[model samples]
Target: MSNSQITAVTELDRSHYKTKVYSGGHFIYADEPTDVGGTDEGMPPAALLLASLGSCTAITIRMYADRKNYNLDSIKIDLAICKEEEMNKDTTITRKIEFTGDLTEDERQRLFVIADKCPIHKMLSNPIKIVTS
Candidate 1:
């Protein structure tokens, strides 16, 4: 984020949707399930999107818990993208968060407020423009 922008490179050969993605000093693979004509090597793109949001939500809450001196043992986040009939072409992400900690209801409520401020959540909630040539 400090660099203002991030870059990643992905290469796809003849292996259907299987692809290798390289980002800075890190690398990952993206693949579809065999039921969808892929080799089922890795998570599909949509899953990665959910993973990003869930991880960010957890990390943000953990940071707040540590700063507030709360006993936060673990955080579980479940994310799903669903399409409702009322909203056309709109993707709705259902995020279910579970917290394991010794804290008051106020503290837990604060975490719910803080979760929305995560970087990924902010990015996805706002307008996005992707350019390709």
Candidate 2:
């Protein structure tokens, strides 16, 4: 099986913890210093994951509309993630997609289906194997 991977390296310095996250050979800085009560200024890992999902959902819908030649004016996605109980064994994410412009009932329904089929949504819904060295 083929797999994709991202690497995140973090270093703790005098001011805050600095991190460099890499995906597809591209790197981005993610740091948060202790002064602001964040363990630095970068987003916590969970927040990053949420952002990915939100972005993927919105983009996927936009792509679908454009491909289908639908007159979609705007697409907005709102997402919230909640951990299950104290154990954190399970997490629930709720997504709300709002579409603007003229759309038929069929087009709207199809968009909802397409949104669920986004890459990030599939990743979150399917079982995942994580290896830590």
lDDT of 2 by residue, 67-88 (tens): 9999999988887777424325
Task: Kindly state the number of residue pairs that clash in model 2.
Answer: 5
Model 2: lowest-lDDT 10 consecutive positions: 1-10
Model 1 vs. true fold: TM: 0.90
Backbone clashes under 3 angstroms, per model = 0, 5
TM-score of each candidate structure, all chains considered together: 0.90, 0.76
* lDDT score, candidate 1: 0.88
